[model samples]
Target chain A: MIPVTIEQMSMRFGAVKVLHDVNLTVQAGECFGLIGESGSGKSTVLRCASLLQDGWRGRAMIGDTSVRDMSVAQRCRSLQMVFQDPYGSLHPRHSVRTVLSEPLKIHAIGDAPDRMRAALRDVGLPAEFLDRYPHQMSGGQRQRVAIARALILDPKVVFLDEPTSALDVSVQAEILNLLMRLRSEKGFTYIMVSHDLAVVDHMCERFAVMQHGRIVEVLDRDAITGAGAKTSYARELIGASLAYENAL
Target chain B: MDPILTVRDLSVHYPGAPVCAVKSVSFTLGRERLGIVGESGSGKSTVGRALMRLLPDAKLSAQTLTFEGVDLLAASERQMLRLRGARMSMILQDPKYSLNPIRRCGEQVAEGVRTHTRCSKKQARDKALAMLKAVQIRNPERVYDLYPHEISGGMGQRIMIAMMLLTDPDMVIADEPTSALDVTVRLQVLSILDDLVRRRGIGLIMISHDLNLVRNFCDRVLIMYDGRVVESIAAGQLDQAQHPYTRGLLAAQPRIGGGRGPLPVLKRDPAWSQPMEIPV
Candidate 1:
């Protein structure tokens, strides 16, 4: 059985079908990438899986337990989400300690202090960061805090939605490397959404190319490793991404 | 050939600040695209704004700030007004903040046109629609009447572009015009800018954080760090850059097929932005 299975998930907003008949699976200890342009419904998929977004059809199964049946607490511990826009995703008013510990308090997890400290260390954050607020920190540091907040719950599945899009290149690499390291040490499933083909190509093992609320194609690294792709849309995306990369 | 715009040991400082926001920055813009790229707070925007003398109420003092053949740094308010938007206009970063939210976009653009040419209101309206069409906006007739809040970010950017270009300025300064846009739409906006500049033969200064975009879009590329141009090179040879700072930036980014490994970390040298370059 897949670690997490999203079967025929569909979402709508006032007659607008934002996502339709979307299916995806993230294996345990594997990075599953969802690559698409803006409004491709990739974020919606992460939102659905993390239970951040409700009012949907079909089953989001975390292992054998259906997401439809899990309690709020169960979902929180087993599924955590890291949002894009590090600045906006985090509460500017809250200190790093508060942001990480508040989730534990909500889940009624005891020894909150010890848990917060451990969480900070897990994401490679120094203890000095504990007293600092999000606004005082750099973008990469804030993103690290965000990662720590997600992993503090020790979730079985971690959903990162455009985690490093806003960050500069040098800072972005640090965050990306941190995510990979944390994944190895923790052994949690990762479902990451990004529009950058280079990022997808570098980090992901299995990828689903999304377009206009549907999964247009799914490819392994070996499928179209180089030169070009079979689908015209994929080729265009790959070409444009390549152009940007080569230009860099 | 004489430079369209020249800066001689230029610097812009905030009030009571020891260091300038932009420091000793010297560059020249011909009738071509010149991109100034750097991270946030690196002072790329200050350079662009300083060019047009629109640096807000901030304290600004420069040795030589010349526009075309005129000495703008010493120009009076009346002289500056005549030069402002009509001669050299700036396309600001965020349209939502820059545009008047309550005013209709068409009227605003038409007003921009009227500032320069003695055209009737109806004639100016027609020209606004034509400019909108030039930017590839498919139904200019309908979009012309909408307020800034009513349009999307990309659409709003297009409107800003129309406004800035309407006056037929000699030099156009665009500050992160497409940073808020998606990848596909960024290409669209840039393509429009490229077409407009080429057709009009206007000097262009594009300020952005994305080095790759700057390298490809601009003719001459200036890599700014901590308010100083660390290096300037031909845009086509950006990858073959000589500066350690530039190489570090290029190394830090992950390319499409740049194989996996420990990512390169940029060591921030105290001398990275220092005026002291390696002895020749």
Candidate 2:
């Protein structure tokens, strides 16, 4: 069954239309890539899905709930988000236990302590990291905490925004592996936003290319082999990713 | 000819740290572009800062950091300040961080000229406009008056390049300069640097985390891991790098034309973080 459906989802902030007639669907347990350049409104769509912003005019159906039409508490159990910058995303003073357990506490998940510990282990984090603060841990460890917090709810859909951009190569590899494994085990649909083509090529099964507030091309993961794009903008992204090594 | 700059036994130690941020690392740069490639926590940036004598908050000591014959280590604050922009300049990684937000772009560029020369305010403004033109800013006159935030990221970087080049330093140390820019814009900036440095025969030290860019752009490559230089090879021989860390770095990247599933990840080694043993 289709897990999430977006129909003609157009978002405008005052006069600037960020997303225009955007339509997408995420299959259950499938990893979907949302690729775009900076200021291309990729993060805006993810924000709408995570229900962080409520002033959007769009048809966003997450699971059985109409997201655009829901109260915050009611939709809290269905989706959770992991932000890109782990340093800024997580509270510096908050313990890992507090950060993870707060989500469980909010969603009314039972046995908060046990659930938090289990979630940490499930995300490939050591049990010792529970009481540590974000600043004490490396970037990879903080990202894992963010993942654990998201998964503590057992949300049907997880929204990851540039999950591994701030990490080094080896650490990024470890996180990527953990993400792939977690998806298979938990069976949660993923809608991840990133500028890295290799990442999109690796983790995503189906992907959409965004340019200047519009979907230029949507392709399956298998179609990433070579020179094939109906739109020139899509071609440019592929070309840029291929030729110019993007900032990691 | 003697090396453009010969650095020996360079080390920068943070307060109360056991080891230096950079160990006894040594290298020499010539007239060609020398690319220093490394990741975060590596002493690559420290190397550049040590050469420029800008390592504030850290204790820096080098056996010898000779810019041609002048010793950067022995140079006084006033003397170094004079040489900084006029004799040698650096383009920082991000223009947003380096460029004065309060100052107009043209005024900033012209100030760079006025610091070294006896030029009048109007003459400095004209020189700044000419520098902008050299970087291919079409309407240099208009952009000169605008503050840092008003310009785009690429435009800001070009303006920075224009300002630095206006001083016409004998050598330039660019620390991850184009890494913040978009691909097309990055290539544009690289081409501009290439043109300016080559035409003027100025020595260039290009420090970046990107191996591919360094290989494609520089004349020589220095691969640094942790705090030491693992390998230094000619640009043409980059692919043939002998060191395992260098090979691993090359392998970690996904080539544009190569087919792939998942790209290979670099294996970390603890030894790379240790001090270097520089032979005499």
Error of 2 at A59 (Å): 1.0
Model number 2 iRMSD: 4.3
For each candidate, what TM-score against the reference? 0.93, 0.93
How much does each candidate deviate from the true structure in C-alpha RMSD?
A: 2.5, 2.6
Off by over 4 Å in 1: A222-230, B16-18, B94-101, B146-153, B277-280
Estimate the TM-score for candidate 1.
0.93
**lDDT by residue for model 2 over A1-248, one digit each (tens)?**
23887778788888999989889988877899999877788898888766687566678888666885667765666777888988888998999988988776766768887887799899888889998999899888888998888888777788899998877666676787788788877787899998877778788878999987788899876666656666888877777766655331
lDDT per residue (tens digit) for residues A120-176 in model 1? 888888888999998899998999999999888888888889898989887888888
Could you tell me how far off, in angstroms, the CA of residue B92 lies in candidate 1 after the best superposition? 3.1
Scored by DockQ, the top model is 1
